[model samples]
Target: MRRRLSEYGLFFRECLRNFHATGAIVPSGRFLASALARFVGNGPAGGQQILEVGPGTGAVTRRIVAQMGPDDQLDLVEPNDRFVEQLRQQFETDPALQRVAERVRVLHCPVEQLAHGKVYDLIISGLPLNNFSVADVQGILAALTGLLKPGGTLSFFEYIAVRRARALLSGRAERARLRGIGRAIGAVLDQHEIRREWIWPNLPPAWVHHVRL
Candidate 1:
C-alpha cells in the first residue's frame, strides 16, 4: 500500500515536470498491464529476450516479470531519473521482484537510444503516444520495430479516444498535432497490428496494440 502510493506521488510529480515525456498522470492499472504482458517471452520459447520502454514505477513491469521464464532476460529503458532510481531500488529491495532481479537490467535512457544490436523477441511499452509529435511517435515506433528479431512482437498502449477528447477541447494547433499523431499510429497499426485488446478497467481506459514482425 505504501509503495503504491509513493509510485502515484512520484508519477504525478514527473507529469507536472514534463508532460511531453512522462505522459500520463498515474501508473498503469493491472488490467492494462496484463494485456500488455500477453506476448512476453513470445509463448514459452524459454530463451526470450524482452524489452520494456517507459516503465513508469514498474506498474506494468510487475506483470512482465511474472510472465518471464528462467531463461528469459529483461531490459528496461526509462528516461526519467526518478523512475530509473525507483526501478533500481525495487530490484534491490522488493521481495516480489528480487527473485528475478539479477536477470533484469535498468537503463536510464530513451528507447530510441538503446543499442540496436541487442534485438528482442518481445517488447512492451507504456509510453503515452498521444502526448508526442507525429514525427517523434513515428521514429519511436520505427526504432522499436527495428530492434525486434524475426517473428518478434512489439506491444504498446494508448488511452482510449484520448486524442479525440483532447482535440475537442484544444486550440487549432493542438488539434492538428493530435490528428497527426493519430495518422502516424494508424499507419503503423495498419501495417503490423496482429492483435489489439481493450482494457476497460484502466484509469481512463486504454487499448493495447500488439504488432508482430
Candidate 2:
C-alpha cells in the first residue's frame, strides 16, 4: 500500500511538471507507451539505429532501450528543456543506457533541425501533430523523410482530435479538415512509396504512419 501511494505521488508530480513545460497535458494513461514498445519489438532487426522525437518523461525511451540490442543506437530529439532534463537524469545512472550512452544522443531542439547527416534505420515520433499547422507538419515530415535510410521506417502516434477543442473550442476546425491533413500527409508518403498503419488503442487512439525508404 505504501509503495502504491508513492508511485501515485510521483505520477502526479510528473504530470504537473509536464503540463508546465509543454502547455499540453501529460498522457492520462500508459497505452501509447505500450503501443510504441510493441511496434519497436516487432520491427525488423536491420533497424538498428532508432530515432525518437518528443520522448516525454522517458516512458517510451525506457521501453525502446529495453528492446534495443547492444549494437543498436537510440537518438532522442526533444524540444522541451524541462523534459529533456528529466530524461537525462532518469538515464544517467542506468548501466544498460550507460553502456550504450555513446550510441544515445539527445538533441535539445525541434525535430526539424536534427542534423546527424546519416539516415536513421527507424524513427518513432510522439509529436502532437493535431496541434500543428499543415505547413509545420509538412516541414517535419520532409525532414524525417530526409533522415530515413532506404527501407527505414518512421512511426508517429497522436491524438485523434481535429482541433484544440479543449483549449479553444471556438477555433476548432471541421473534423473533415483534420482528416484532410492526415490524408495529405499520407499522399506525400505514398509518393515516396511509404506505407502507413493507424492504431486505435491509445487514449483518443492514434494514427501510426510507417514509411519505408
Candidate 3:
C-alpha cells in the first residue's frame, strides 16, 4: 500500500508539472478510475473497444480493465516514454489483467498521429484543454471525433473552476486569452453533437462531456 501511495504521489506531482508546462491538467487517478468504472457500468452496450488518450500512469487503464469483459480490447495512446514503461511494468504480472495486457496496444505516440480511419466504441481522454490554443483544441477534437464510430461516445473531464481561478489570480492578459480559448473549445465541443455532464465527486471536481457521434 505504501508503494502504491508513493507511485500515486509521483504521478500527481508529474501531473502538476505537466499542467504548468503544457496547460494539460490530469485528473487524479482515483477520480478517473471511479469515473471509468461508472462509465462502463452505465454504458448503453457493454464497453468493447475502448481507446484512451494521455493515460499518464494507467490509473484509468486499470479501472477500464476491471470494468470491461474479457473479450474487450483497450488501446492506449501515450507519448511519454517513462509513463509507457511504467504502464508495461505495473500490469505485467496480474492474472486478471493478463488478457487486457495481451489485448492492450500502447502506441508510443501523440493522439494527433493516431491513424484516422480506425474507430473505437468509447474514447476517454485526460488531456488538459485549458492550455491549448484554439487551433490545437479544434484539431484534437476533430481527430478524436474522427476516431469514434458513429454513435460511439467520447468522454473527457476537465477542472474548469481551477483553471478559471488560476486565470483570475494571475490577472494577466495572456491568462484571460487562455480562458477565452478554453471557452471557445468548449463551445466547439458543444456545437458538435456532444452532451455535457458535470461530476463533483472528483478532486477539484470536473465536467465530463460525452459526445455521441
TM-score for predicted model 1 compared with the true structure: 0.96
Point out the higher-scoring one by lDDT: 1 or 3. 1
TM-score of each: 0.96, 0.74, 0.82
lDDT of 3 by residue, 1-213 (tens): 764675566576776666542233343557656664455534444447788898877667777877877566788898877777777776686565675687788888889899946788888887777667667777888898889887777887777476667776775776866777677666757666355556666666777677677
**lDDT by residue (tens digit), candidate 2, 97-149:** 67667778888999898886977788887776655666777788889888888
Weakest ten-residue segment in model 1 by summed lDDT: 39-48
lDDT of 2 at 51: 91
Leading candidate by lDDT: 1
Q: Could you give candidate 1's per-residue lDDT for residues 70-124 as a string of tens digits?
A: 8989999998999999999999999989999989999889998997488988999
TM-score for predicted model 3 compared with the true structure: 0.82
Q: List the residue pairs that clash in candidate 1.
A: none
Q: Model 2 compared with the native: what TM-score?
A: 0.74
